[model samples]
Target: MDATGDVILVQGGGSVAATRQTSRTMKRTANLQERLQEKSHAVGERADAVVAPLHGGAGGESELADKAGKSQMLEDASGNNVSLMRTMLRAMLHETSTQLMDEQKKMLERLWDALMGNQRMTTQMMGEQLEMVRQLQQEVQAVKTQAVEESRKVDELRRLHEQSTRQLRVMQEQTSEQIRTTREQTTEQLKIIREQTAQNFEQMRLQVMKEVGIV
Candidate 1:
C-alpha cells in the first residue's frame, strides 16, 4: 500500500508542473504578436515622409510653366498692336498724296483753257485789220482814175476855142474889099447917059427955025 500511494502522489505533482509551463509559453507568444504589429505601423510612417518632397517639386514646376506661357502671350499681343499702327499710318499718307495730285491736274487744265481762248481772240483781231486795209486800197485806186478823166476833157475844150477865133478874122477882111469895088462901077455909068441926051436936043431946034422963016 505505501508503494502505491507514493506513486499516485508523484503523478499528480508532475501533471501540475506541466500545466504551469504551458500557461507561460502562451503569455510569451501574445507579447511577441503585439510587438510585430507596432513595428509595421512605424515603417509605413517613414515611407510617407520620404516621398513627400518629390510630389511638392512636381507641383512647383507646373505653376512656373503656367506663368511663362502667360508672359509669352502678352508679348505677342503687343507686337501685333505695333504692326497695326504702322499700316494705318501708311494708308493715310497714300491718301494725302493722291488728293494733292488731283488738285494739281485740275489747275493745269484751267491754265491750258485760258491760253487757248487768248490765242483765238488774237487771230480774230488780226483778220479784222486785214479787211480794213483792203477796203482803203480800193478807194484810193478809184480816185486816181477820176482825176485822169478830168484832165483829158480840159485839153479838148482848149483846142476847139483856138479854131473858132481864126475863122472870124478871115470873114471880116473879105467884106470890106467887096464894098469898094461896087462904088467905082456906079460912077462910070452915070457919065455916059448925060452926053447922049445933049446931042439929040440940038438937031431938033435947027429944023424948026427953017420951016418958020423967022428963026
Candidate 2:
C-alpha cells in the first residue's frame, strides 16, 4: 500500500486497541461499583441485625438513624466518584480521538502531496524517454538514406569504369592497325629507291667507257 493507506491501516489497529482498553476499563469499574454497593448493603444489614438485640429499641433508634445516614452519605459519595470517573474517561477519549484525527489528516495530506510529486516526475521521465526514442528513430532513418545514396554512387562508378575500359580497348586496337600499315609502306619505298640507284650507276659507267675509247 501507499503511505496514506499504510498509515490508515496502522491507525485502525490503534483504534481497536484503544477501544478494547476502554471497554476493559469500563467493565472493571462497573464490576467494582457493583461489589462495593453489595458489600455496603450487607454491612448495613448485619450491623442493624446484630445491634438491635443489644439494647432496648428506644436507645437503638438514634444509633440506627446515624448508621442509615452514614450509609446514604457513602452511597452518594460513591455515585459522585463514579460520575467523575465517567466524565474523565469520556474527556480523555474525546481528546485522544481528536488528536488522532488531526494527525491522520496531516499525514494523509503529506502522503497525497508526495504521491502527486512522484507522478509528475514519472510523467516527465516518460516524456524524455519518448523524445529520445523519436530522435533515435530520426537518426536511424538518416543513416539508411545515406547508405542508399552511397550504394547508388558506387553503382554509378562501376558503370563508368566499365564504359572507360571498353573505350580504351577500342583505341588500342585502332592504333595497332595504323602502326602495321605504316611499317609496310616504309618497306616498299626502300625497295623502289634501291632499284633506281642501281640503274643510274650502270649508265654512268658506259658513258665513261665511250669517252675513254675516243681519246
Candidate 3:
C-alpha cells in the first residue's frame, strides 16, 4: 500500500475510536440521567403511598385520597427538577474524581522530580536529604489520613441513604437489591481511591530511597 493510503487508514481508525468513545460516554450519561429520574419518581411515589396509609383507613378515605393525589401531583412536578439536579450532581462528582486523579499524578511527578534533584547531593547533604524524605513521607501520610476521613464520610452518607431507602421500601413493600448495589458502588469507589493513594505513596517512598542510594 502507498504511504498516503496507510496514513489515511490510520487517521480513519483514530477517528472511529474517538467516535466510539464519545458515543459510550453519551450513553453512560443518558443512563445515569434515566436512573436519577427513576429514583426521583420512586421517592415521590413512596411519599404519596405512605401518606395515604397513615391518614386513611377510616371514614376519611376519600379526603385522604384527594390529598394524596394532590401531593403526588406536586411531587411528580418537583421530581423532574430533582432528577435534573441529581444528574448534575453526579456529573460534578465524576469531574471531581477525575480532578483528584490528575492531582495525584501531578504530585507523583513532582516527587520524582524532587528525588532526581537530590541525586547529585554530596555526603554532607545526605542527612538533609533524608530529613526531606522524612518530611515528604509525613506529608503523604497526612494525605492518606485525609483520604481515609473522606472515605469514612462517603461511607456514612451511603449508610444514611441506604437506611432511608430501606425504610421507604419497607413502608411500601419492596426489595433491597438497589440499596445493596448502591452501597457496593460507593464502597468500590472508595476502595479505588484508597488503593491509588497507597500506591502513589509507596512509589514516592521507593523513588526517594533510590535517589539516596538505599535501594
User: Which candidate leads the pack in TM-score?
Assistant: 2
The residue-by-residue lDDT of candidate 1 on 1-215, one tens digit each, is 23223323433534553344334444544554465445445544444444444555568775465445544544554454445444643553354345434544655677688888888988888888888888888887777777777777777777776766666666666666666666566555555655655666666677777777757
Higher-lDDT candidate among 1 and 2? Answer: 2
Clashes of 2: 0
TM-scores for every candidate against the unseen true structure:
0.36, 0.54, 0.27
CA lDDT of every candidate: 0.55, 0.72, 0.70
Kindly list the per-residue Cα lDDT of model 3 for residues 139-205, writing each as its tens digit.
9999999999999999999999999988997965544766777799999999999999999999999
Q: Which stretches of candidate 2 lie over 4 Å from their true place?
A: 1-59, 174-215
What digit string (tens of lDDT, one per residue) describes model 2 on residues 1-215?
13234334556646664455456556655775676677667756765675555456646676777667666766766676677666866765565567557767876888899999999999999999999999999999999999999999999999999999999899889888888888888778877877777788877777888888942
Model 2: lDDT of residue 175: 85
RMSD in angstroms between candidate 1 and the native structure over all alpha carbons: 49.5
